[model samples]
Target: MITARYHREIPQRYRLEAGKCKKCGFIAFPHRLVCPKCKSQDFETIRLSDEGKILTFTIVRVASDKFSKQTPFAVGIVELKEGVKLTTQIADVDVDKLEIGQKVKIVFRKIQEDGKAGILCYGYKAVLI
Candidate 1:
């Protein structure tokens, strides 16, 4: 069973949908009701570009209980070609090889499972391109 919060994010998670502010040209992921840049409530729907570059990253040595089994994984803020900066798990690369400006592309993957019998949450992860 998935929580309401998770269910609400299905669109963004599965489709990489974003809302671009109609006035300021600012794009917000997860579809914010208010624009963070210019206080505008109007926006246009946009799909985020899958290709991007690693702006920054950190190797997670400690994680929450849900992700304990995936300890030491790398997470990074990737700036997509559309100029949207989003945090995502960096996958399929050695920690030593991680670096700023490394080219990456979005890949759909299982983010986590809520419980032993819970639903599997799938989302996009950044992978070296």
Candidate 2:
């Protein structure tokens, strides 16, 4: 059985779906029922931009058990063209050369697996453009 958290994130993880506040034009990633900015309950589903620029980054030398094998990776807060910012792991680049303001594009990739069931979890990762 898929975990609740994983099942809950299917839309955002697979299609990059977000909720846009119909009343105030605020976009919320992961689709919130209530708009944080204007406290509005009305929202429209929207797809986020696939391309973005790195706003800030950090090199992860240590990571949780599920991700330890991929340590020394670069993770960054990317600002999509629509102005939505999301934290994602930067892949397919030299970690030493990563910098803020660098261009990147999101790509679907395997994230990790469920221990005993060997369930493969997939999600988005950013690559230099």
Candidate 3:
């Protein structure tokens, strides 16, 4: 049963979500609504591993309005062990020392704000392994 208001995003943000295309071998991270490569409507939900490697990252010196208090936080794309590349905030890390190809593991953490009245959003975030 879907438990989130944003059910479409629940698989990706709240769980170790992944997508497998029925027509091709392309796998998508963040659980696409449709396969970008094949435009396939059929997909299988896969839970990814907690481990991954840092593909790239940057420090959010100028964070968004919702993330203003979290400015200068480290964020990056991590290619998980399942080969699904995902964008997530890098936690348990010092922003100044982060580097590419660093080993990481997934953890559930406070990901973002929900305006003034909404669920305190929680999602998968990566921490140094």
Candidate 4:
């Protein structure tokens, strides 16, 4: 069964939709009921930019069971052109050559599976530009 949280996050996971606070121009990924900056309740739905630059990164040589098959993957904090920062797996590149400030573009990809016959979860991953 899909949890409400998972259902609620489909927009962010699939389309990178965020909420822009009307009062202070703050963008919240996965949105929020209240603006974290200005404590305002008003917001406007916005789509985040797909392009970004890696601020920092690390090679995950050891990963959990769910991701062990994809070990030695790179994960990074990417700051989108709109200035919203998010942690995402960096894919389709050599981990050793990854550097801070490297340009990347977000893409939809399979994230993981829940069980033997479980649902396949999908989400955004960054690829070198």
Q: Estimate each model's TM-score.
A: 0.94, 0.94, 0.85, 0.95
lDDT of 1 by residue, 26-118 (tens): 999878999988899999999998999999999999999899999889999999998989999999889888999999999999999888888
Worst 10 residues of 3 by lDDT: 1-10
* Most accurate candidate by TM-score: 4
Error of 4 at 14 (Å): 0.3
- Give the clashing pairs for model 2: none
**Stretches > 4 Å off in candidate 2:** none
CA lDDT, every model vs. true structure: 0.92, 0.91, 0.84, 0.93
Superposed on all Cα atoms, model 2 deviates from the true structure by an RMSD in Å of: 1.4
Flag clash pairs in model 1.
none
Which ten contiguous residues of candidate 4 have the minimum total lDDT?
1-10
* lDDT, candidate 3, 57-108, per-residue tens: 9998997688998888999999988788888999878899999999999999
Output the TM-score of candidate 1: 0.94
Tens digits of per-residue lDDT for model 2, 55-120: 999999999988788888888999998899999999999999998899999999987777757678
Q: Candidate 4: where are CA atoms >4 Å away? A: 1-4
If the candidates were sorted by their lDDT against the true structure, best first, what order would they fall in? 4, 1, 2, 3
